[model samples]
Each structure stands twice: as structure tokens, then as C-alpha cells.
Target: MRALRAGTRTLDLNRRIAVMAIVNRTPDSFYDRGATYALDAAVAAGTAAFDAGADLVDVGGVKFAPGPPVPVEEECARVIPVVEALAPHGLVSVDTFHPEVAVAAMAAGAAVINDTTGLHDPRMADVVAAGNAALVIAHSLAAPRTQHPLPHYDDVVADVLAFLRDRVALATAHGVPEDRIIVDPGHDLNKNTRQTLELTRRLGEFQELDLPLLVALSNKDFIGETLDRERGDRLPGSLAAAAWCVAHGARLVRVHNVRETVDAMRMIEAIEGWREPVYELHNTRPEGND
Candidate 1:
């Protein structure tokens, strides 16, 4: 797969996993509600994420869990300022399925559109294509504000792979290049605990698509349920899940705790045999001494 370049940083799929920090600019995000709602707070969060070694920052306006919906105009208003604030820093991704928000975010200099609804909105592909930005196609079986009650799959891995393949084809048919697409299984979106766990365990199956896979299991409800902890206490479980995902072929991890995730990624890379390349060899002795 070709590397997707966002400003000075190029995300090589063959290299170690890339970390995408989550910066929710909404007032009701499940994890970080109101943490980054203000423009100044959002900027500070973005800077802190970058300083902590995030390869990208995902900014979201509308919280997509089981909650009341915000109008598209309102969502656009909430996301655009953060996108503008983070533009010059590189690799800012807007997390929304609304076409208007996606367009506005791109206009504000976001490099990627992370649509958790998997392009269910007809105008989404066009907006993303118009901006020539990367798109994260995350699979959710239901609408943006609802959860999938009693979700079932004949074979979760195969179904996810097929769904993502079709979504990629749809985007490509709409003029979005294949290289600019990434796939996510939509970890907690519309999925029950068992389904989410199974998807995480079988993440490697989706690699057959050959596009960059982004696993976003950070601080989600499933982790909390499994670990028997609150949202704030699920950091260790989140890090563990991220490491497992990276080992299983995920190229990018969307995380809430940027610093901890960065440290965990470094540890995973070291265990996976990552080593610095030797670029120079010094010779102290004279050239003809031997």
C-alpha cells in the first residue's frame, strides 16, 4: 500500500502502527465531554496530542453514541473552528458523517474525513473527493445516533470485510482514489460486547482489503465492561487492545490517551523488533591505514 502523506509526516502502512489522538469538541462525547469544546481548549488538546507523539488528531463535533442528535449546521459550527485551529499542525481528521460538516472541515484544512456511518450519507463521498483528503470508512449497521439492538452476523469477520470492500468500491467509483481510503470495523458503534470482542480478535481478517486499517478501541464501553472499570480506569485495557490490534495488522490506532498510547506503541514496536536504521558509519582511522 502507498503511504498517505499528511503534511510533513507520511504514514507508511508497512511501518509500526500510527497513533490518532481523539479530540472531541462536543459537549456530550462519551469519554471526554466538554473537554475540547472551546477553540482554545481544542488547540491546546491538539498541541498536547502532537507533543505526545500522535501521528494524527481526530476532531469530532457530534457525539455518535446513543444520544439525542445535533443538527448538521450545529455540528459543522462545532467542528470547523477546531479544524481551522489544527490545520497547520498536520493530519487533522474530522469525525463526522454529515456532508456539510465534512465539507466545512475540509475547507478548514482537515486532512481526513472519518465517517462512522460508512458513507451512508450520499454526499459524503463527493465532499471527501472534492477535498482530495483521506477518508476513514467505519462500519455501523444503524444510523448515526442509534445503536444496533440485537445486532447479528452470520460471520462477523467476513461480513465486515465484505462491507468495507463494498464501501471502498463505492468511494472509488465516486472518484476517491483507492490509496486515500482507510477502513475501520467500527469497534463499539452499533456492536454488542461479544461482537466487539470478536471483531477485535479477528481484526487481521480485514487486512485482505490491503487498505490502511484503523482500529479505534480506546476507552470504549466494551473495554469498560470487560475490565469492570469506569471510563477513566480503562486506560490499561485500552492500551492492551491497541497493542493487540497493531500486532494483528492495524496500521492506525485512534486513542483518547495520547501519551499512554504512544508509550504502548513504542513498547509494541520494540517487542516486534523495530530498530533504528544505521545511516552513517564513522571511521576514525586514516582511509589507507589498513
Candidate 2:
């Protein structure tokens, strides 16, 4: 995989896996409801995530699930401060589908704009390109802030890949450089548990696209349903899915639990031979004196 350059931060996909810690500034987000909704709380969470070894922090002002539309100004007010506070600490991404909000976020020191709407807003790419920011285009079938129950596809993985390819093309055409683009399969968004499972199993197929593949499968409904676990008890399942995605060619994993995901990814790196122990003494050869 090629390296991804998000403004000033460049992630070398070939040698390292990136863990994007999720920080929701929304009160009604699926996870962490109202925990970080306050500006001070959000800033603290972002700092905490960065200090915990996250390669990047993804800050979202609006919830992905169907809900009332958060006005562009409100969304900006919610996330821009958090982004500004965290950008100096580490790489930061603002998750929003509104073009105006994207522009405001970039101005507020965000290096990446993560649009979960799959670039549904035609002007979003232009706004990102103007700011010279990185773009994360997710695969969601429905419109932003809307519901699509029981969404169908002839072949889930193939369909997702095709949609991502087209979105990439659209983004590039709008002046966003190719190297600054990342693709996400949007696990659990507009997909059933079975479909999400298939996507995770076949995530490697997306490698053909040649961009960084980001999977946001942390504590999602699929894991809960698959393991019959509740929201707070899905860490094990989330980590398993993360490891599988990395093994299957995913370069980035977005999650709520940073420390656990960081540890898991490090273990994966060592097991896959991408990394080695700091000092291996258990099997070292004996010296001449010995």
C-alpha cells in the first residue's frame, strides 16, 4: 500500500498500521453518548487518545445513525475547537458530511476530513481540495442523516469496492489529489450483520483499489449481534475484527478504544514479522565466555 499524506502528517502504510481513535462531540452518538459533548470534555478525550498511542484522532460532531440534522454552524462549533486543541498534539480528522462544516474544520487545524456520507454532498470534495486536506470517503448507500433499512446488493464486497472506486474518481476529479484520499467500507452502516461479516471476510479485495483501506468496525452492531454481546462488552469481538482486517490488507483501523487497539496492532505487527521485539534475549547465542 502507498503512504497516505494528510496535510502535514504522513502515514507509511507499508510499514505501520494506523489506529484512528474516535472522539464524538455529539451528545446522542451511538457510543459515548454525551460523554464528550462538552468542549472541555471533547478536548480532554482527544488529548487522551493521542497520548494513548493513537496515530490519529477522528473527531465527529454529528452522529452517523439517523437523527435530526445538526446545523452546519452547530457542527462546526462542536468540533472545530476540539480539532484545534488536538491538531498540535497529533494528526486530527474532522468527521462531517456538510461541505461548510468541512471547510470550517480544515480552517480549524484538521488535517483530514472524514465524510461518512460516501461523498454524497457534491461540494464536499471541492471544499477539502481547496483546503489541501486529506479525504476519507466511506461507503454508505443512503443519504446523509437518513435511514436505509435492509439495504441489498447482489455482491456486498464487490458492490462496496465498486462504490469506493467511483467515489475516489469523483474526489480526484474535484481536485483532491489521489495520495490524499482514503477509502472505508463503512462496516455496519446500511448493512446487516451477515453483509458486514462478508465485507470483513473479503476486505482484502479492496486492496486492488491501491489506496489506504480504513475499517471502522469498533464496537459496531455487527460485533454485538454476532457475539450476542452488548455495546460495552464488544471489545474482544472488535479487536478480533480489527486483526482480521489488518491481516486482510486494511491499513487503518478506527476505534473507540485506543490503548487496546494499539496493543493489538503491535502484537499483530510482531506476529506478522512487520515488527520485532525490542531486545530478544530468550534465544540469544552464548558468548565465547559462556
Candidate 3:
């Protein structure tokens, strides 16, 4: 995968997995349950997460599930401050389908625009290209913040691959540079546990697109139901899934637990030899020692 740049910060994602910490600013978000709804709280959480070793902080002002519609101004008001505050710390990606909100966030120092709708909106790619920001095109069943119940896919993996290929081409046609684009197989977004699992099992298929593949499987229903664990107790499952994705082909992981994900991924990298060990003392034979 090519390197991804978000504003002044860039992620050299070669033979390495990058972690993005999720910062939800909505009061009714599924996870966190409004813990960081307040501006100060959100900023603090993002800052702390970055310090904990997150490569980027994905700031989302509205809940992903169906809820009250948030105005563009409201969304901007919710996330811009956090993005500006976290700019110097590391890369900041704004999760929004609204072109207006994406533009505003980029103006405030965001480097990546993670539109969960997969560029369903015609204007989103234009905004990303115009801003010269990176775009994360995620595959969603339909428009984000809407309902698509009882979803059906003939072949979940095949469908996801085709959708991503078409969308990535569309983004390039819209003038969004190829290197600045990323693809995500939206887990549990209008998909049931079975479909999500199948997608995960064949996750490497997404590498066919030849772009960075990002998966947001942290504490989602698929993992929880599969393991019969609650959200608070799903870290182990989440980490396992993340490690599996990295081993398979996925290059980026989005999650809430920044510190744990960082340590787990570092260990995976160390074991795989994709990253150098910090101390290099384990199981090493010193020169002339034997």
C-alpha cells in the first residue's frame, strides 16, 4: 500500500499496521455512551489517546446509527476543535459524509476525510480533492445514518470487493488522487454477523484493490455475538480480529482502545519482523557467545 498523508502528517504504512483512535462527540453514540460528549472531554480523550500511541484520531461529531439529524454547523462545531487540538499530536481524520463538515474539518487541520458512505454523496470526492486531503471510502449498505434492515448479499466478500473497486475508480475519476484514497469494508453496517464474519475470514480479498484496507471491527456486534461477550469484555476478541486482519492483508485498524491496540499490534509487528524490536534482547545469540 502507498503512503497516506493527512494535512501536515503522513503515515508511511509500508509493511506496518496503523491504528486510528475513534473519538465520538455525539451524546448518543453506541459506544462510550457520551463519555466524551463535552468539548473538553472529547479533546482530552483524543489527546490522551494520541499520547497512548494512536497514529490518528478519527473525530466524528454524529452517531453512526440512526438518530436525530445533526446539522452541518452542529457537526462542525462538535469536531473542529478536537481536530485542531489534536493536529500537532498526530494525524486527525474526520468521519463524516457531509461535504460541508468534511471541508470545515480539513480547514481546521484534519488530514483525512473518512466518509463512511463510500462517497455515496457526489460532492464528497470533490471536497476531498479540492481540500487536497486524503479520503477513506468505506462500503456502506446505503446512505449512512439510515436503516437497511435484513440485508442480503449473494457473496459478501465478492460484493465488497466489487463495490470497493468501483468506488476507488470513481474517486480517482473525481480528481481525488489515487495515493490519497483508502478503502474500508464497513463491518456491521447493514450487515449481519454471518456476513461480517465471512468478510473477515476472506479479508485478504480486499487487497485486490491494491489500496490500503481499513477495518473498524472494534466491539462490533459480529465479534460480540460470535464470542458471546459484552462490549466491555470484547477487547481480547477485538485484538484477535485485528491481529488476524493484519496477518491477512488489512493495513489499518480503527478502535476505541488505543493503548491496548498499540501494544498488541507492536507485538504482532515484532513477531512478524515487519518492525524492529525495541531492545532486540530476546532469544538473541551474542557474537562469539556460543
Candidate 4:
């Protein structure tokens, strides 16, 4: 039985799956682009997701893809208000690799720091430890905002496992407790579609990390390419991949579609015997037999 403690929200991953709904404040993010870039829209999106069944909300000001550099101050500006506003609703995780932004977000009420760059700046870990905030150390082979063309790996899963193991140790050594840390395989971050699919297939191996595993697979190119579908039409594939990962051992799923992901996860949990039906009296008896 594993539990993830993000501020006051503790999730028992043993019997349930946690949904981290995406609330990107960046205007150029692959999904939703500038839809939620506005402060009001972003907050509304977060609030709506929470109402729809999200366990946590991840707020990011910068896109992971290579783009014009957003200064630390600008990044802070983009997410601080959203974090301060959303913190009271539930757990809010600020996505950034810069230690300065991380600390600011923490001060503004963010309970978790989701660094997609695999904690590239070691100082980021110290900030998390200082605030007693949860840290999400994701595996990314390239630096932030930099492209890695045709990145090759001897074994994608094995390599990712090794990288995460080392990063976990580094984070713990920097004063962040193991229980306060979550690891993300970072599908499609640096790896191509094939590697991302492999990670999805063998996600159970990440369980060895002994901590909650987060997979950010919402409308990613891997699903789109595999199904020959566009971003807007990849919900089915995304849900299918998410269900597979949930069955394989992913504890948290970062997604764009909250309702569908929640429904799929609940269904999967029921199938896995980790959850029970809310109403068991649905047509169990034959017509007029009851």
C-alpha cells in the first residue's frame, strides 16, 4: 500500500488512482495552447477539473518544447497568481525547473514542484526540501526547451529506470524525503513515440522506485502517431494508454480531459478489484423477479 502526501492531500495509491489535471498557463503549450493562458480561464479550468474529479492540479507557465526563453520573473508572474488562487481548493503543483520559480510558487501556496527537466538544477531539490513540498522528478534526456533529435538509447526502459534511480538518490540527498517525492517517466519528453509506447507497455517496472509514479500522457504525439489521429481526436487512445498504465502500476496520471480520465480510472480500478461499485443493486434480478 503506497501513499502520496502532497501537502494536506494524501492519496492512497494502493486502492485508487490520482488524476493530476493540466492547467497550463503558457500560451504555447502543445495542448490547449492559449486557452487557459488568461488568469481567470486558468483558475476556472482548475476549479472545473477539481469539480469533475481531479485529485490535483498542475500549473505550468512555460511549454516543455523548445521556444523563446521565458525569464524567471515572467514564469513566476504567470503561475504565482494561479497557484495562490487554487491552493485552497486542493493540492496545486507548480511545474518548473528553475529553483527561484519553484521557491516562489511554494511561497505562494503550491504544495508540489513538478520539474519536467528531471531536477536539472539541483538547487530545485533543496527548495522543495526547505518548503517540505512534494517533488516530481521527471526523466528528460535533454535540457529544458532544447530539442533532442533522434535520441538513441541502448534500452529505453532500463535507461529511464537508471536515470530516475540516480535522480531519486540525488533528491533525497538534497534533504527531500523519499515519501515526499514522486517520479515521472516523462513519456514523449525526450524519447520518440516508439520509446514512449514501450514505457507504457512496461510501466510496471517503475514500481521498483517504491514511490508514486506519475505519467504525463495527455494527447501526446505518441498516442496520436500510433492511432493516426489528431490531437483533438486522441482521447480514446489516451484513455486506453492511461488504463494500461494504471493496470501496469502507474499511480498518477496527468491528463487534459479530467472527466474521461476519471471515469476510465474508476472503471479500471473496479476491474482490478481495487474499487467497488457505488450501487450494487443495478438490475441484478430478472424483470418482476425482485
Candidate 5:
């Protein structure tokens, strides 16, 4: 049985699937586009997600898209307040690849540092270990906000596995415990739609790593392109894909629609017998009390 420990919250991955709600404190988020950019709004949104069944909230101060470079001070300013406010409520994971940002957020009580860099900055492992926080080493071939047009891979899943394996070794060597680390395939990081789709279909391959898998597939471009739908219209596809990941081997799902994702995941879990129905009385009344 595997488990994830994040600050005050610990999740038993062997017993059930977990949800990590998204709280982007940036003005150009692909989904909300800064709707939750304000400090108070970000806190409120995270609080609502926690109430709706999210096991944790991922607070990101910057978008993963290319734009102006946000200074370290500015990034810390944006993330620290939200982390400080939300830490008391539930698990809080700060999504940033910068070692400086990781250092500050952990000091502010973030349980996990969801670094999308896959340890691009080696100092990240040391910084996270110093805080005694779990580290999410997301697989990404490109630097955050950079472009890798028409990226090619002989075998994308195999390539991702190799990358994650190397990063895991690096982290462990830095004194980060094996149990305190997580891995993410980074749905659309640098891959095209076809590659992302292939990755999704075979994400179970990641289970070989033997670490908790956290898949962030909410309203991503791959889903949009595959279904010929826009960002807002991709929930059904996102939910379906999330369900598949959960059924296969994803221990945690990072998502935008917390309330709805929780609903979908619980239903899937119930169907799979990992979760029990809230109540079943449609002819289940001792099989006779109609």
C-alpha cells in the first residue's frame, strides 16, 4: 500500500483515489484566465474546492505558458499569501519549478512542491527536503513557458518513463525519501495532441515507477483538440479521461472543476467497489420492503 504525506493531510493511495483542485493565481491561466488571481478569490475558490471533496489544493502563482518572466520576489508575493491562508484548511501544494519559490512556499506551510520542471533545477530537491515536504516531479521536456514546436519522440511513454526515473534517482540522492516523492506525466507540457492522447491511453505504464501518479488533465489542449471542442466544452472528455486514469492507476488527479471532478471520481470508485454508495434503496430495502 502506498501513501502521500503532505503537511497536515496524508492520503492512503491504496484505499482510494484523491483529487487535487487547481487554484491559479495568474492572470493568464488557460481555463479561468485570472478569475482566481486575486488573493481573496483564490482563497475562497480553494476553500470551496476543499468543501466539495478535494483532498488538496494546488496553488500556482504563474501560468506554464510563455510570457514575461515573473521575478522571484513577485512570484513569492503572489503565492505566499494564498498558501498561508489555505494551509490551515487542508493540504496545499505550490506549483513552481524555481528553487527560490519552492523555498519560500514551503516556509509558508506548503506541503508539496509540484515542480513541473522534473527537477530542472537540482537545488529543488535540496530545498524541498529541507522543508520536509513531498516533491511532485512532473515530466516536462521544455522549460516552463518555453516552446518546443512539433516535438518528436520515438516512443513518448517510454521517453517519459526514462525521464521520470532519472529525476527520481536525482531526488533520492539529494536525501528526499522515496515515499515523499510523486510523479506526473504532464499531460500536454511539450507534446502535441496525438502524443498527449497516446500518453493518456497508456498512462498505466507509469505505474512501473512505483510512486503515486498525479495526472493533470483538466481542460488541456489535448482534450480540446481531440474532441474538436473548446476549453469550456471539454469537461466531459476531461471527466472521462480522468475516470480512465483513476481506474487504471492514477492515485491523484489535478483538476479545475473540483465539485464535478469529485462527483465523477466517486461514481467511478463506487462502480469499481473501491468506494461505497452513499445510499442504495431503489429495491435494496432488504429486497422486500417495497
Candidate 6:
């Protein structure tokens, strides 16, 4: 696995999975609504997430829930302030697809751009390249703020892999280095329950891409449906999915419950060390020699 550089900090993938705490700056985000919509609340949430062992905090504007589109200026206004406030403490990732928002957030000291649009916006790549910021090219089949109907895939894993591969290639061709890129499968972005499960089950397939993989499976609707829980009650399922992702070679996990997820990951890491066979051969000889 390649070393993922978020600003001056570099995460060695073989060591452990990086935990990214979600800090929603919008009022209507599916999870953590109103948790940090205001500047003061945003700062407090960021501090708590960092204290809870988050390697990065992803701040987002323009809630992506099914609704009318928010103007680009409003989106920028909502997120840039939070980014600016949290810039000094740790790595901050701006989750926005608009090129203008990307530019503004970077100016506010965000080190990464977590674009759900997969760099579909022509100018988004250029903005990221110009800022020398790390880019997360996430797979999503439809635009934000609209209901994504159930989409079909002949092979869900293969299709997701190909889509992410193509997006990474496009970004690289536009001057973004491979080291500065991360790919996400975009869980629940445009998938049905089965498709989401298949993607999660086969996440290891993306390891062949030779880039760090990020799984955003925090409180998504698919988890809610699978476990028969409301959106707020999906923490256990989310933690389980996160552990599964880590075992399958995921390098980054974007989640809402920072402290709990961090604890779960630590426990998983400890258990992971035990998975290797511990017995060693004492003085042994070939059968014929013996």
C-alpha cells in the first residue's frame, strides 16, 4: 500500500486505518443534524472529534439529503468558516463537489477535498491540483440533493471498481499525483441494499488499484434498512461495517461516532494482531533425517 499524505502528515496504510470524524456544518445532514451547523458548535464538535482520536475531520456544507439545490455561495459560506476554525488543530477535509466551494475551502486551510461527485465537475480537478490538496474521488451514480432511485449493476463490485479507477485516472491525468489521491466506493450513494452489501463484501477488490481506499459507511440508509433500525440507531451496524472494511484493506473510515468508532477500531487492531499464527517450529528435521 502507498503512503497517503494529507498535507505534511503521512499515514502508512500497513500500520492502521485512519479514522475520519464527520462534522456536518449543514442543518439537514442525515446524521449529526445541527451538531455543528453554527460556527461555535462546529469548533466544539471538531475539538471533541480530535480528542476522541480522529485523524481528520470532514466538514461539509449544502446538505445532500433529498431537497432543492443550495446556491454555491451559500454552500461555501457554510463550510469555509468551519474549515478555517479547525485548520490549525488537525487535517480538515472539505466535502463539496462545486469547484468554487473547493477553491474557497482550500483557501480556508482545508487540506483535502472529499468530492462525492467523483470529479465529474470539469473544474474541480483543476482546483484541487492547483491547491496541491489531497483528493478523495468517491463513487456516486447520481447528483446530490435528489433522490437516487435503485440502480442496477451487472457486477456491482466490478462496476464500482471500474468507475473509481476511471475517476482516479482522470484526476491523475489532470496533474493530481497518485499519492495525493484516495478512492471511496460511496456506500449507499446510488445503490440498493443488496448492491451496497455486495460492494462492502468485495471491498478488497479495490486493493488492486494500489491507492488508499476510504469507506464512508456511517449511518447510511442501507445500514438502517439492513438492521431494521432508524437512522440514529445504526451505530452498532456502522461499527461492524467499519471493522469489516478495515479487515479488508480499507485505509480510511469516515464515520459519525468518533469516540466509539475509535475504540472499536483499536480493539479490532488488537484482535487483528492475534489473527496470525503464533506457533514457531522448535528444532525440526526432515522425516528421512529424523
**Residue-level error in angstroms, candidate 6, position 50:** 0.4
Candidate achieving the largest lDDT: 2
lDDT of 6 by residue, 1-290 (tens): 88887776777877777899888888887777677888889889998999899989999887655788889999988888888888899999999889999998888889899998788786788888888679999998877667778698999999988998899888988888898999999898888888999999988999999999999999998899999999889999999999998889898999999999988877777677833334535445454432
Better of 5 and 6 by lDDT: 5
lDDT by residue for model 1 over 243-268, one digit each (tens)?
88888888899998999888888777
Per-prediction TM-score: 0.91, 0.96, 0.95, 0.96, 0.96, 0.91
Worst 10 residues of 1 by lDDT: 275-284
Q: What lDDT tens digits, residue by residue, belong to model 2 across residues 1-290?
A: 77888978777888799999999999898878789999999999889998899989999999999978788888888998898899899889999999998888888888999999889997999998888689999999988889998899999999998999999999999999988999999999899999999999998889899999899999999999999999999999999999999999998999999999999998888887889876766647676333
Q: For model 4, state the Cα shift of residue 189 in Å.
A: 0.9
Local distance difference test, each candidate? 0.85, 0.91, 0.88, 0.91, 0.90, 0.86
For residues 112-217, what per-residue lDDT tens digits would candidate 5 score against the true structure? 9999979998999998877778999998887767877888989999999999999999999998988889999989999899999999899888999999999999
Displacement of the residue 23 alpha carbon in candidate 4, Å = 0.7
Q: How many clashing residue pairs appear in each of the predictions shown?
A: 0, 0, 1, 0, 0, 0
Model 6 residue 46 CA deviation (Å) reads: 0.9
Instruction: Estimate the Cα RMSD of every predicted model relative to the unseen true structure.
Output: 4.7, 2.2, 2.2, 1.5, 1.5, 6.5
Model 4, 175-215: lDDT tens per residue?
A: 99888899999999889999998988889999888889998
Better candidate by lDDT, 1 or 3 = 3
Better lDDT candidate (2, 5): 2
Task: Look at candidate 2 and give me any clashing residue pairs.
Answer: none
RMSD of 4: 1.5
Model 4: what TM-score? 0.96
